[model samples]
Target chain A: DTAVSQTPKYLVTQMGNDKSIKCEQNLGHDTMYWYKQDSKKFLKIMFSYNNKELIINETVPNRFSPKSPDKAHLNLHINSLELGDSAVYFCASSQGGQGGYTFGSGTRLTVV
Target chain B: EDKVVQSPLSLVVHEGDTVTLNCSYEVTNFRSLLWYKQEKKAPTFLFMLTSSGIEKKSGRLSSILDKKELSSILNITATQTGDSAIYLCAVINDYKLSFGAGTTVTVRA
Candidate 1:
C-alpha cells in the first residue's frame, strides 16, 4: 500500500485556467507539506500544514493556496495558472516535524 | 532565509568511479541534514545525518555531517549506472527543510 499518494499524476492545462492537485497520506502523520521542483531541479517548499494549521508559507504568489481538510490530506489549488507554474508538485508527510518526509510520486503540471 | 547549496551542479563519471557530492548550508537552528535521490518523478529518501563526525552508510552510499562547519558531503563508491540521478541535499530545521539545487550525476557504463 502507498503511504503518501497524489492524483492526477500529470496535469496538462492552458494558461489562465485553474486546477487543483489532491494529496492524501495514510501514514497517520500530523504534518503535510507541498514542494515545487522546477526545471533546474531546485526543490522549494511552498506550504506546510500541521494538523490542518498553516505553518510555513514561503514567498509563493497569492494565486496558490493550500487547504488541509484534515491532518491526512493537503491539496494545492492554483488560480490563473501561468507558464511559470509548470513544475512538479510533490506532496509529503511527516510524523511531527521531527521525521523525514515520505513523499508522493508527484504531479507534473504542464501549463500551456 | 535558510539556504542549502549543492555543487558541482552536474557530474559525469564511469560506473566504477567514486564521486563526492558536496552540500553546504546556512540554516538557523539546524537540526539535521537529509539526502534524497530523485530520478524521473519522485525523490526517494537516501540518508539523514545529525551528529558531527559520525558517518551514515547504506550500500555504496555514505554521508557525513559537519555541523560545526555547516556542511556535509555524500560519497558514492563503486558507482553503477543505476546510481545516476539528481541527488538533493536539504538542511532540516525545526519544521521545514531548505533544499539545494540538486546535483545531477551521470554514471556511464
Candidate 2:
C-alpha cells in the first residue's frame, strides 16, 4: 500500500494562475512536509506541518500557503504561479521528531 | 549557512565495481543523517544514522556516520547496472533537513 499519496501527478498551467496540490498519508504520521526539486535535482524543503500546526517555513515566498485540515492531510496552494514555480513537488510524511520520511511520487508542475 | 555537501557529484563505472558516496554537513543542533536512492522517481530511504561509529547495512548497501568528523559515507559493493541511481545525503537538524545536491551513479554492465 502507498504510505504517502499526492494528487495531480502532473500539472500544466499558465503564469499568473493559481494551483493547488493535495497530499495525504496513511502511516498515522503527525508530520507532513512539502519539498521542491528543481531541474538540477536539488531538493529543498518548503513547508512542514505537525498535527495541523505550522512547524517549519523556509524562505519560501508568501505566494505559497499550506493548509492541513487534519493530521492525515496537508495541501499546498500556490498563488500567482510564476515560471520559476515549475518543478517536481514532493509530499512527504513522518512520525515527527527525527522519524524517517515516506515521500509521494511527486507532482511535476509546468508553468508556461 | 547550514548545508550538506556531497563529493563526486557523478560517477561512472562498470559492473562489480565498488563505489563510495561521501557526505559532509554543517548544521547547528545536528540530529541525524540520512541516505536515500532516487531512480526516475521519488527517493527511497536507505539509512538514518543518529550516532557516531554505528554502521547500518542493507543488502549490498552499507553506511556509517562519524559525528566527530561531521561526515558520513555510503558503500556499495559489487554494484550492478540496476544499482545506478542518484544517491542523496541529507542532514536533519531539528525540524529542518538540508539535502545535498546528490551523487549520480552510472553502473554499466
Candidate 3:
C-alpha cells in the first residue's frame, strides 16, 4: 500500500470556485502536513497537524483551511480560489522526531 | 525565519561523471538535515544527517553535513541516466521541515 495517498491527482476549476483535496496515510505517523509547490518548484509548508491538533499555520490565506478528522487523514479546503492558487499540493506524513517524510503523489490544481 | 538555499539551481552531467550539490541553511534549533530525490512524482528520502562530518551513503549517492557552517553536500558518483532528478535539501528546525528551492540535475547518457 502507498504510505501516503491523496485524491484527485489533477484538478481544474474556474476562478472563485471552491474545491477540496483529501489525503490519508497508513504509516501510522503522528504528524501530517500540507505543502504547496509553485511554478518554480519551490515547496512551502502551509499547515501541519500533530495527531489531531493544529500545530503550524504559515500565514496562509483564510480561504485555505485544513481539517484533520483523525490522525490518519488531513483534508484541505480552498474557497474563492485565485489564479495564483494554481499549483501542486502535496500531503506528507512523518513520525515524531523522524528526519524524513513520506509524500503523496500530489494534486495539480489549475485555476482558469 | 529559517532559510535553506541550494546552489547551482540546475546542472547537466554525462553518465559516469560525478556531480556535487550544495545546500546552506540558517535556522534556529537545528535538528537534522535531509536530502531527497524527486522524479516525476513526490520526493523520496535519500539521507539524513545530524552530527557534523558523518557521511551517509546509499549506493552511488552520499551526503554529509557540517553543523558549524550550517551546510551540507550531496555527492552522486558514477552518475547514470536514472540519476536525473531534482535534489531537494531540507532542514528540520525544532519540528518543522523547510525545503530549499531544489537543484535539478539532468544526467545525460
Highest DockQ: which candidate?
2
lDDT (tens digit, per residue) of candidate 2 on B17-97: 999999999999899999999999899999999989999999999999999999999999999999999999999887866
For model 1, the superposed segments whose C-alpha errors exceed 4 Å read: none
lDDT of 1 by residue, B6-98 (tens): 999999999999999999999888888999999987889999898999999999999999988989999999999999999999877878878
lDDT of 2 at B73: 99
Q: Which ten-residue region of model 3 chain A has the weakest summed lDDT?
A: A93-102
lDDT on C-alpha atoms for all candidate structures: 0.93, 0.94, 0.94
Candidate 2, pairs of clashing residues: none
Q: What is candidate 1's lDDT per residue for A20-74, written digit by digit as tens? A: 9999999999999999988887889999999999999998999999999999999
Q: What DockQ does every candidate get?
A: 0.78, 0.82, 0.74
Cα displacement (angstroms), candidate 3, residue A17, comes to 0.7
lDDT of 2 at A75: 96
- TM-score of candidate 1 to 2 decimals: 0.98
Each candidate's interface RMSD (Å, one decimal) is: 1.0, 1.1, 1.2
Give per-residue CA lDDT, model 3, range A1-112, as digits (tens).
Answer: 9899999999999999999999999999999999999999999999989988898999999999999999999999999999999999999999973566889999999999
- Using lDDT as the measure, what is the rank order of every candidate, best first? 2, 3, 1
TM-score of each: 0.98, 0.98, 0.98
